[model samples]
Target: MSDLQVGLISLGVVLILVVLVFNWWQDRRMRGRMREHFPETDRDPLMGDVTPAPGRREPGLHLAPASGDLPAEDAVDVDPNCEAVIDVTFAQPVPSDRLHAATQALRAVGSKAVRLFAKNDNGDHRAILREGESYASVQLAVLLANRSGPLTDIEWSQLWTMAQNLAERFDGSVEGPEQARVMARASQLDALCAGLDAQVGLALRLGGTRPVADVTRQVKDAGFMLHDGQLAWLSEAGMPRFVLLYDGVQVRDVQSDGVDRIDLLLDVPNSPADSQAFSRMASVGRDLA
Candidate 1:
């Protein structure tokens, strides 16, 4: 090999080594800075005392409490008929603060909502866990069905796993209905929802394409406000009673060219029941026409 060629190869190798060493040193320095900023501690600032207290009684579980069993102020909005519930009893009464901190990450499993209720010494279940109070048991309720659809096996498993983990953490025991029963209930609930789910829409077609901005201005003037990219007609409670779409797309997505048609939709399940929903929609449709 030529001496010049060997020297050039040696230079390239040395440069590569230098780059690697520099990167390693930079990473180490950044890690040191992070450690200084966040020093390791035996007790967590959020959740203190990882160990369970001594002389805790054995955990147990039971069926969900009836609505009448809970006080009005502490009642949760969960429906026992349409929810998969798990009862968890701790080996010892756990502080509300610790329970709240532990459950911060367990609000939902996929599309299904999970609700927690704590039980006090009086056997009263409360949705809001009060600070400084200790709870003997808790109920975890997962909604079986919603607009998204029925809870699947994966979601059920996730709930079970989460419950099991929570039980282990608090030296507790969890009991819930069989997976098959939960799945069957979820299916029935979904079918019932499917029968009642309804959406009414009216289309306004123009003689020719018109500027989207002009149409939006007219809509806004007529008391429709932009919400989440779509134009919505809200009720007095600030809830959307109807939504407007431009050419099957969100009103905010229309740009450059005008639209030939606009669709007004009323989601029946979401609208207020006493608002004369259909009658009001028909009246609006006539006016728009």
Candidate 2:
């Protein structure tokens, strides 16, 4: 090989070696930092003795209830059965407003709802922060399921990041259930909720296209009122019984020449159970048809 070509080949090999060494150094530094933050332990203090008792189902994903040192208000806002929780214990009492302000940005992680609860000097846990009260610790909870789906990995990571930041800001220690356990619980909760969720829809297909304004007028005349851009059939309590859309788009946003199809949907989960929701919705669908 020519001298120039040989030199280039040697240079390429040295660059590859340099990149590998740099990656190794970075990884080692990260590991060291992690070890400092999360030292090895014989057992997880949060999940004391995971061995299942005889003839009982294994424990579901949940952190042990806050000790006497934590807040009782957790029951009011955080449901352990359907939430992943992180507990932050401060070295000293902190002002409620300061902690509240720090957590405002963490009210939501992705689509999952996040809630914060603090334990005041009176030993009561409260969701609402009292400006003059001081709190010793706080609990953060992320809902695992909703209409959208289960809590995803990205959302979990975001929650963890927020919790870590809170701990650093307050000079506190962070404790939480293992991520694997939390994720398993989330999937289970999502499945249970999905089984109970129900939505009914009916489509009306016209013989010919009709102007948007004309259809909207007829719908309004039929007692459907505009709500959040969609046509809604409201109950005596002013709650939506059925929502109407034109070709799957909001009635107000349909920009087509005309609308040939419209759909009516009843979300059972949000409807009042005593209303004979399905029967009434079916009757409405039949009448509309």
Candidate 3:
């Protein structure tokens, strides 16, 4: 080979080696950071094996033991729980004296996915207990998202352990749905969420003629309420059925003479997966168009 060609080949090899070394260093640094956040714990057989999968990026909750001990809250998983709606009722009514401790314990224990609810005398269910007030009975709708989707055997055990602790401390007797029933419902919900697909939108051509404020006015005039940075078209009972959002394109696109659009997204996961809801949303989109 010519001297120049040989020199070029050597340079290419050096560049490739440099890239490999840099990648290795980066990976090492990331592992160190992760360890700092999630300290090494006694490997639990219940967690199964962490096999590497191509293009897979889900975080697994490493348990300390097969005995249902929970991990640190800071290292808690961020994925949506498989069972977003767990019905938690007490076996025995919580007495007035232990009400504060019960509420605080329920609130403090478990990951963010856990939410406690109770019904008032008027038959309205709500989270966050009233101050200086006591609940006759309580319910928990713990979000099962941290363990990633469907509840594993280990995850279920951890949940039961947490529930038992709360019940023991307070006068509450933790009542959860039957294991088979809970698993079946959670599986169905996960399947629906996986197959969810519905988005309706409309583009209002301002024709570079009217001001951007007119766009907002037109949406409001259509009887859609805007609040908390979300636009919702509510039902007769004031419950938000779907969301109406202003579509954003390039920053310059919204500027003078740029195209503007709006969308009505019916999040199927949040709503019922029935033909009726889809039909209503489709009708709304058709009308807007």
Instruction: List residue ranges in candidate 3 displaced over 4 A.
Output: 1-112, 120-124, 144-147, 197-289
User: What range of 10 consecutive residues in model 3 has the weakest lDDT sum?
Assistant: 58-67
Question: What lDDT does each candidate get?
Answer: 0.75, 0.75, 0.51
* Candidate 2 local lDDT, 21-131, one digit each (tens): 997796676556545543455543323545644684322122233355654454566787888889888888888667766776766888888877778777777766665
TM-scores for the candidates? 0.51, 0.50, 0.33
Worst 10 residues of 1 by lDDT: 56-65
- Candidate 1: what lDDT? 0.75
Best by TM-score: 1
Per-residue lDDT tens digits for candidate 1, residues 1-289, read 9999999999999999999999779667655654454345444332344455478422222223344444445644457888888888899988777787777777778988887777865566767766556788887789999988999999989989988999999999999999999999999999998998788776767657889888888878877897776789888888887888888777767665798997888887777643355455545544454
Q: Which is the better candidate, 2 or 3, if ranked by TM-score? A: 2
Displacement of residue 211 (Cα, Å) in model 1 is 22
The per-candidate count of clashes, in order, stands at 0, 0, 3
